[model samples]
Target: MSNRPYIVGNWKMHGTRAMLAEARAIDRAAERLIKVEVALAPPSTLIHACRKEANLIGIGAQDCHPADGGAHTGDISAAMLKDAGAGFTIVGHSERRADHGETNVLVKQKAEAAIEAGMGAIVCVGETEEDRDAGKAEATVGEQLKASLPEGEAAAANVTVAYEPVWAIGTGRTPTPEDIAIMHRNIRAQLVEVYGEAGQEIRILYGGSVKPENAVELLSADDVGGALVGGASLTAESFLGIIIAAAGDDAE
Candidate 1:
């Protein structure tokens, strides 16, 4: 429905300069990848260096401040990231939403900030295991989506929605195909409500415990445009496999 499905690798706090070897490898391996829009968010320290590498993949930051100019010490605004050649940014990642106490208001601000800086924002929303076990998964995720997502009127087309269940993220756990379907459907429904006709254009990605081995199947699911990969995305080969799988049907 959108221009192209995008697959994003969120390196989180896991990369160092040595990881550049992997980034380069991924770029080289992805030489033939055209059906999917591939990008990665490496550690902030490596953003500039990653940008200077091969040109196949998109480069983005983990996060940014809401304001262009700010008195907040240690805060990097969207303008700075844009100047550094970032084409995307991550907002409301589960860790930030939970650990750092980031609120939906804050996440919304950061998304707006990304638009201001000339970049796309990957906004994340999910539910904890407790919520899932209680059959409250949809309810929890719905609330988060409502607060975390900007109405189509509020945010531009540069927004990407990621459905990452906190229960499954990095815990070596994953949702069943049925569960994934329901959550994504709910997310899409909410987007339609907020964005109206424009909601069909939002790229909805499934994240959490995504690996090369399981990638293709995940990408093929209904409404699953791509993945917001974690652990498996650290390496170029592994990450590339996922991309290759996402582009499986398009193979010619």
Candidate 2:
């Protein structure tokens, strides 16, 4: 929490037991970098395995169901994720929003459920390429953020926001640092308005094909507390590079 850069890897639907080696390697590297707080949200199937392999780094789930239980088949609930050793869950990811047709209201419910189940919620909000092109990026993100977050101190304490433009995700394209900073500032303002002082401390991560090459500068942007990395985070080497970038400012 404490302003220490929170670098999280969203493995999405990829990874299996074979990838555990890479996760272990990432955990070993993370142990050496005390300044950065690293975590991985692997496929739900690997959450417990990853936790068992590495105690130093955090382990999370990519997504969770809003309901605690029922005949929701194929869907895992926040409580189930927690029981599986997931300390956090990423909600409202663009992929989930688009593929599953998840609405902001549903995202908000999932976030609240995560907190209720004793897990942190990394709520994602973003504008599609069309929205960005239309100069409604900030407006789109603002609306999503407002609708997707839960109220109260505990919710604020357990929530982190991520801005991953729909177009940029998995496309290797990213906004300039200035553009990132502007969007982050806008999101930060909204958080403050909603959560007051607590909002200022909510970590806002930038996720969009984040890679080692640009990790340093991107992580250095104003109000950019961390990153929600994609492909680059699949391996220990590349992911460690970004972790090292986060450690720079706090390196002794």
Top-lDDT candidate index = 2
User: Where is model 1 more than 4 Å wrong at Cα?
Assistant: 151-154, 249-252
Pull out the clashing pairs in model 2. Answer: none
Give the per-residue lDDT of model 1 (tens digit) for 155-185: 7488889999998899878887777888899
Lowest summed lDDT across 10 adjacent residues in model 1 is found at 148-157
- Give per-model TM-scores: 0.94, 0.97
- Candidate 1 residue pairs that clash: none
Q: After TM-score superposition, what is the CA distance of residue 102 in candidate 1 from its true location, in Å?
A: 0.4
lDDT of 2 at 189: 94
User: Which stretch of 10 consecutive residues in model 2 shows the poorest summed lDDT?
Assistant: 243-252
- Candidate lDDT values, in order: 0.85, 0.92
